[model samples]
Target: MMASSNAIEGRHGDASPPKASINACLPCRKVKMKCVIATHAMECNRCVRKSLDCTFREHRRGRKPGTRLSHKSGSSISRKGRGDMSTAARSSPRRDRVSDFWADSEGLQPDSLLSHQAMRGKFSLQNILSTDHGGNIDGVATSRSVPPDDPILLGLINQQVAMGLFEYFMEKLNPYISQLDPLLHTFPYAREKSSFLFTTILSAASKYFRSELYPVLHDHAEKLYAECFRRGEKSTEIVQAIMILTYWKEPNDTRAWTSIGLAIRIGMDLGWHKLRKSARDHGGLPDPEWREIRNVERTFLVLFVYDRSLTLQTGKPWMIERNEFIESVESWGEESMANSNDHLLCSFVALRLLTGDAFDLLTPHRKSPLPRLNRLLTILQNRIEGWRKKWLGAVGPGNCHVFLVQFYGAHLQLQLFSLPLQDTNIPDMDGVGDIMPFWVSYQNSMAMLELVTKYFHFLYLAQDSVHVMTAYAAIFLIKILLSAPSTIVREIETPTIQAISDATKAFVSQCAPPGSSCTLQARFLEKALRDYSSPRNHQSRPLVYNETDNQCHGKDGQVSVPDSRVEGRESSILSGLDLCDQTQDVPDLLFGDDGSWADLFASTGFNIQEGVFFS
Candidate 1:
């Protein structure tokens, strides 16, 4: 029988054999073309070219020539291509696709398979990308566990002066960034909890440390910062570190713009923006956890202030949107809290809110008619002054100096709009009028100059914001000199101008250490003064009308009196304006397109995302 079977197989092998190409992908088979693929695992050329899902299946052996199929087998074969999809899908494919969700398994018991199947119930794209567990968002802890071998940790521990630097930060710098509780964030607690935060604190107070150690500390902090993001770590410490670094930003540093933005975003991710009803309404003596919550709230408010500051400085759009919770923060000062610094924070936040309101109010209507825009400006000014009247005398002790800088800073910020809005020929504006009277900004500039020059101690521990404020005042004074009348120009004693110039130089000196880039608003101011004295750029026209007899003539032949506050000074830099320079034709420095004050600041390369100047 074996001989007979072998002889029969040999005879059949001689007949036409089955084609192996039947396993080729459908697209290639439809075209009756060769399906070329580098390997069996990949798509064939034709399907790849068409961007189609290439699939192949094993072909069953053709029926024997003498065999007859039963009716049931033939009916099943007919139903294979045409049947209810659900019923058809219930059956396994002839070929194993090896999909994780549906591929058949062998060793697993039914219970185990059910457990495996349940794992995907909560699957989501964000969960898969951002969370450590399948769908458990909180599965990933916020407190980053510092490894013993972490370079940041080791560096801090090895430095004998690390604790000393931390003390310097707590003593000198902590007041500026009062969100951190000194008692809670003790040296050991901070060092052990987050190396990034510890390194940042040391870096901020590095002026007291060895000057050479600043870079090393900063580099370590930055590395840990990037590592935190890489590991998807979320915590209050990281956000505060970013804010601190941004506030005490390096010279020519552009990183603060985007760094603050990222901090705000991560803050939202941590739900800092969400004030739960229970979190807000908790009563009686606060628990330790509640204090932690309040600290978080304080940080959030500080972040908002930082955001508004950026908008005012760089003309960038703010990231944190206004909401009811933020709107109510101005009232937080009235609330009794265990921490005294919070009262100061409340006042600061209130000031920032007013500044933000000014930005929002005027930014959109910049092109609107000056009358409508001025109405909005007047409203903002009223609100700001109301804030001043209410909060000025109420500032906590020792906080008055900082509050004054910001108060005058707000005045400067509001006046900045005048430089752009003063140009009546600005192609976009609907009508011509000045919302920010020329005298208003002029007085604010003198006030700012007087404050900075008088306090002088501000330069010792001043943040970048204070330095920028000084620059704004100096630049505003210098630029207005062109159209300023000889009377007003003479009144601005050479000593005052020299003093203002010296103040700017002091700022550059303070912020620019060994290799850092500090604010160059002073350089531009010098350039403007030199150009003003040059023979070619000496032409001047009546730029502003000074108040004579406590009144001035408007363009409509109507008499208007300047603000009474403008009268107190013995000499005013912008007290009068009508200087005439006939030596050469010069453009209007305050209003002309090329000479616009806005153009001067923009020339400093203030792109936030690129970190241009700050980098």
Candidate 2:
């Protein structure tokens, strides 16, 4: 039913001699259509009809053999040069071409990585178009111009607070959350910068401001966050801002999850995740440019760690896959400023690795098990301990964030081991020894509770606790205490939990502009603790004396009898470890292996050694 070829061509039959189809012009290639250029035509038919110029541009070569080269690059010689007239000129061109091929060979590209990242839109040029800021920012076009408020006036009223707030984020929250640029010491040209980060910093710091100004500061932050996001400006600062705002969300709420994912997507488009490799390509860049590159790396690291931690927490599958840049976090070195909290970043990278591995070792969460649970746990603990030893050596007076993460990672190790506790099929009736070695995970849990106190003690002396870390520590401690026997809690540790709860409430009090997510989380945890400590929550019944009854019944129809004979709740921290039968007794050799470091701490008591930061 289709028209014959001659019939289709009747109108222009022999007007121009039939010419072989050449490579598609750039305009046609951009839209991915065929090119039809007559022998004498200067432009492709599509461009001729559309009244547009037909351009041809050289592209970077594709790596694979038989790779689809740009249409015009199909032959060894370009169309214009195909019939070379001069042999002497050809030889000179050949030498230059060979030299150019091997030039700038310092950087390495993993061929395997390209294909993998490609699926995630790694090489798309669409991001290149959007990265110019104007294309990205939507809705309100005013952002394309200067801010409505005069920069001079905005700075004047908030100068002292703004500078201190930026430092606060850099110090107190940044190490814990890891979002701010490490290089920028103060707010630099705020009116010209991305309002998102500026407002977010002010909003976060607003919680700590005097009550009179809290509402004003927080409102300003909220408006800017809304405007910047609603009208997206393509800048890396947008990514930074998204991360800080995510921290402001309630713990476990998916409200800000989407925003973070967007930030990561934009970050990848900006090639922030690939900054290290790209930076390596251009050696001898200025210090400011290098700092910008470092900022991207640091920001990407923060994004990676936060994304993974939340993934692990929620039992959701990971969004970003592991990559080489993340692995290089440990080996890469920086000449950090004095007390720059650089150790925290290094330790954090190491800690994130443990969590990434934790993702795999975790049952069902990971696809399959390679190293057995015991093997995995021992490896992780030893590695974490190694990390602690390294970071502790460098700990300054203001190292609370690093200290918290050390214990937090340790807690996560045990927490991973206890993942089976969540499996409904696994009975947790006489909880003490059923799921995991109750005494062991319990010790880590107890140790975590102690660490919470120490974490705050350090915060109180040096800096304030970040809401996210505090909430995480709160979640860890509460999970244990929700069912734990009141009697088993140390007389000393009990007061610490109370102190945490009290401090949380005090934080709640100062949380201005109302409904601050961190303060709300603190209030919720405080109430939960208050309920747990109520008189009615404690068990009053005497233990049954029946010979057949092996489990001791505790509060609210639960059992707390400690026994080491239990199986499957294996002592994965170290192999061949057996606990002393008594509930209160700890083993002489904590891991049953010689030189178990835990035993040294047990013997010496869990006290912070002089000049030692953390064990």
Candidate 3:
């Protein structure tokens, strides 16, 4: 039993520790008996104390094949390696030799093979980055970067610049275009890049040049034209630029005429044949595309060819040869089949510019040379009158009601300017007829007067009345006195003059604010007296103070004391003191006791007929 116990102890206790051998770890190959992963420095306390290799075969009994193979390197099988070898075997040298024979016989570069392979690898990398990695390192993003020489983008930017330049060019060149200098700094680069920017700039410079910049603008325009022509870009756009330049040139320059002629020739060559044919066949209306082209052509033609002041110069009428152009225009109108609105408007503007003074020249002739002018004027007059009636019916009875009133006024002014100044007694030309020249002028003047009065009335009634009223006071005083007719002057008998004086006194009292522009007001009142109280008092009738009262008292009825003596007493008393010495002969009712007509006339330096002279 003792021997058996000793054997058990010997077996259990260690039996001389079994020659303490080292077993390298399959993963680490370090000196130790305990497993030592390389990540743990290939050492364990138990192996170090035993003085054995701190190594152990990776535990594989319960682990996966992949885990067991980690310690063996190439000792394990690989499906991918097996498949690759199989593929190589399938594409062996026998097959490659046949492909090489065909490829070599073709004499193609063998480097293409390597290049294609490299390209495939690059494409694969790009696809991987773009699809799987969400990176933008590929060439697609960089391809969209704008280049300085790109034609399309440059053209678009140039167009934007052109639009801005056209709007502000005149301001840039003319110091007087605006008093504000800050306006110039607002848009600088926009003016530099646009093609049409030079046109507007030259236009403004020509329009407002203070005689000093005339030569400058002229030289600039010439240089611009030469540059465009030299560039071999004498397109329709270049022609338009030249035409605008010519328009702003000195009116009498031979070069101006030559430039205009060249521009017209170029324009006609571009498409004027089709334009003229379309205009004639279509009756001022053509297909939309053709019409747009025609409109641009006509705008250039109008700007280049026609000058109203020049047309009116009798000595140089033939210098411009306006009659030929007018004949052409008339023929174009007759041939046109479709009448477009734009064409009609352009025709109206062109005709007015061409024939404004021809009407006057022809009116006195035994035979009218311009029957077509008469017809065109009649048509325009009717259209304008119809439009005026429509607007009048739509608007209310306030000053704002006349917002569109200027359109009618301008049309009438054009018509009046178109009338002949000859003293012909033609029935149609007489002021008594339905289409009478004087009747139209009178109507237009009346409308303008009404508008002026309404505007002043608005100022008087408005809440913030100071500034607006001051502006209107100057405008109204100027319009009323300056625009009234000589006929109206003659027909205002003593009664009408007296009534007007009373109204004037009332109007003046309302404008007593010292800050207003009262100089015009004072001058108007002085002029009215001087004009109405002259030797022509026999021709003048006093203004009617009240319409009802004037109507009730017949023209031949017994005389009533004029309302001027009663209504204007206070204003005349205050204002007459200043004017008493100069206006003593004028019949002022302010100086008399009880404001009697005779006493006031005697005391206030009143004269019945020899009117006051303010100046």
Candidate 4:
């Protein structure tokens, strides 16, 4: 069988001879004549001969043709082109293109980014770039917490002392100030140090002033005044501080008053010379000018003197007698008259006389002996009108109008307080005719009211202390509302009152700790609101005595309802029976209850709680 098969193989081999060619590896694509397809793997004999790298997979038995071979290097090569190449090349270019498009569309240039970058580097850009979602990068930035030794804090301390809120502010700032020595001092005159001190003092002063901590404020102010005097550094700020302190203190001490007097004299002396020169150079107070700078100085002197007089009257251990102050004002008026300055003289006399007797005589029951408020109002109105006309051509009419408004409001307040509770009963003086004519000058009254309201609003808003401003504004609004006519009240809701309430609420919500200055105002407002709103005549009981009949009240001592419950009501019968009863006074019946009487009285002012009509 083997011999026969060898003879057959030899014959077939001769019939067809195989081609002689090198087998090539799939990866290298190189062929070699000595290449062995199976033992050398897929690599050609040439790659094997040259000792080059070959990443070809060995064919597996029964595997489908054209399938990817299993090899680590082949997998890596396939992933390289598909995964990383395009991405690596395209990322930077795409970002640059986007940035460029954004810049062009938004009108931003490359230079802006560069400039910003430069500035950022100088200022440490890391902080600027690290913004959270809130977009409040600098919102958390803190002011330099003033050191205890800082001059600014010292100034603030002095101001607080003046404003009477030192202890309160100190308590609030205790954590910070406690760490500092009382005598710790910063540089003598470094700008930052000075500014810091000044700002702190101003802030504290504003806070204390608003809080209405008057006692501590006055004490602090006096101390500061003395310190400034001792330092011999009487700059404008110091002088102003002293002036404000004097105003607030209304100092009764002879020495303190004398010092204030001296300060005033010094201010006057400095101011008078300048004013005289200005008048001389500018041609005698100029056209439409009613008062010169000298006049203003004199006005301040008069006001200060008047304030001192009031202090003497109201202050403890009153130094100056009321009669003596009145005499002095009379003399001042005479002097002003002698100088032919009727405006100043009139104003002086009017204020002095009005403030003394206006409150007592103007009320419903008290009789006034002084010039009737109507007369004063007339005089003021005429004067204001003249000034307005004269000054209109020169200065704007606004200032003149403002002056008129202030005078009007002041006079109105005085007059309102002076009026009898029943204004209708007070007959007009025969010669005066109807003073209502003057009072009815709606244009003037409205203008003045608007101006006064604005000023009050400004004060209320600008004040840092909620308690102080709220109290003051409340009082002011009360006074205004009380004096305002029913029509006026009906026409306008006080914006100042609303603002004060809102501001108080806000401040309380923000800065007021559990027990704080703001909380007091809040409580006050709440109480005021409640008190104002409670119903009048809440205590009055329905009259039922006359309605009790024997039939309704059975013999068995039990009450029975009638079949006609509506018509048989005993209360209605009693009301009719009591109507003509001469024994009862109508006024007594109406106002018998305290609630009714109190509500009647409360209607004169803003009763926040009741929301009643301001009569």
Q: Identify the candidate with maximal lDDT.
A: 1
For candidate 4, the 10 contiguous residues with the lowest summed lDDT are 174-183
**Candidate that would win on TM-score:** 1
lDDT of each: 0.53, 0.46, 0.34, 0.33
Deviating ranges (above 4 Å) for candidate 4: 1-223, 226-238, 245-279, 282-373, 384-457, 460-529, 535-615
Q: Single out the weakest 10-residue window by summed lDDT for candidate 3.
A: 79-88
C-alpha RMSD values across all candidates: 19.4, 17.6, 32.9, 36.7
Instruction: Name the weakest run of 10 consecutive residues (lDDT summed) in model 1.
Output: 77-86
**What ranking emerges by lDDT with the best candidate at the front?**
1, 2, 3, 4
Per-residue lDDT of 1-615 in model 1, one digit per residue for the tens? 011222122223456533437545433443446555532223444433333334443332464443322322212111113211112232224322222222221224542233222222222345434322222222323455655634455654355577788888877777665668776778777776667788888887785445667777777778888887776666677898888777676665567877888788777766666542222333333354445656677778888877876676666788887666677775554554535556556666777766655554554345766577667656766766677666555655564345553445455444645544444332222233442545456666666765654554445565667656655565566655644545555555343345454444444444444323333443433343333434332332222234354333334454322332323431222233222233555445534443466554444333323333323
lDDT per residue (tens digit) for residues 403-484 in model 2: 6666666566655655534332222335433434334454565555456445544432122223433444444454444334
Lowest-lDDT window of 10 residues in candidate 2? 605-614
User: In terms of TM-score, how similar is model 2 to the real structure?
Assistant: 0.56
Better of 2 and 3 by TM-score: 2
Q: Residue 157 deviation, candidate 3, in Å?
A: 16
lDDT of model 2, residue 489: 39
Instruction: Put down candidate 3 lDDT per residue, 24-62, tens digits, no spaces.
Output: 222122112223212112233232222222223222244
Residues 1-615, model 4: lDDT tens digits: 011222122223465522222112222322222323322132223323222223222222343443322433322221112211212232344353343312212113432233222221122345335332122211212344433533335553353343333233323331111111112212232223333233333334444344444344345545555555564332222333443333222212224445445455434323221221111222222221222222333344443444443342222222222343333443443432123232333343344444443444444455543456556545654654554443333222322223332443343443343243233422323444343432333333333333433443222222111122234334334333333443443343234233333433333343332233334444444333223223211221111112445122223344322212123332221223221112321132221133443443344332333221132
